[model samples]
Target: MTDVVGIVIVSHSPLVAEGAADMVRQMVGDRVPLAWCGGVGEGVLGTRLSDIRAAIDRAWSERGVVVMVDLGGAETNSEMAIEALPPERRRKVVVANAPVVEGAVLAATEAASGAALATVLATAEEAGARCRSVPSKTSAGRRQ
Candidate 1:
């Protein structure tokens, strides 16, 4: 609906997807179209292609849409949903390889700024690289 790129969040848990969407809404407000989907149904913890497709539809924008997902299953389902879209629509949607919550926030923030779909995706994926670059402490109390 908005000129800015749209954002969609997917997760295995319904609460996680909704919570991440809530954070984006709180921080980004109504600057961009945003939607989220998680779980199969009735408290079940799983991702569904139909749900993802619906979320993408809800968040569709002429500018394009960036999808952030948690877990391998979620990513797989997201990809499947994207593939199901009409060729033109499929071109405008992408599954970002970034942590769901953080990526959704960053992607949404960038999209709200009227950035292009590719730029928004880059912003979201950057979160994953930044997270990986952070040194982790080993059990031996040494940075790994």
Candidate 2:
């Protein structure tokens, strides 16, 4: 494992997860260990404990891993997967309570900077607030 923290993206749709992972890759490059899992199989839309566990393993690092999930079921399965890991390994994993795509990108960016696991997770969790704070254009085309 690298010195940087790792990241895992989980989503109900395979395309969503892959798209997020691709964004992270484009932004952070390979400086951080990254992995993603979504959908059960054969074009199905669901998460599997085994797949999540495998992604975690693939993204494992001594610095730790932060998992970003798109929905409740993904979060549940990710939690179960973390719990199933050996105690030592499990302690280093956490599920980030942030928007899946944005969180994964931000988390990976932080991790690629060699930030600690806690810092990376915090960055991911803060994504929602950051998004909320952004100025948006109103229907009239004025910033709102």
Give the alpha-carbon lDDT of every model: 0.86, 0.86
Model 2 residue 103 lDDT score: 89
Error of 2 at 13 (Å): 0.7
After superposition on all CA atoms, how large is the RMSD of candidate 1? Answer: 6.0
Query: What lDDT is obtained when candidate 1 is compared to the true structure?
Result: 0.86
lDDT of 2 at 108: 91
Residue-level lDDT tens digits of model 1 in 40-117: 788888888898999999999989999998776787778889999999999999998887888899999999888999
> Per-residue lDDT for 62 in model 2?
96
Model 1: CA > 4 A from native: 133-144
Residues 1-144, model 2: lDDT tens digits: 579999999887889999999999998798889999998788888888999999998998999999998766787788999999999999999999788888898999899889999999999988867766542211232110
Top TM-score prediction, candidate number: 1
RMSD of each: 6.0, 7.1
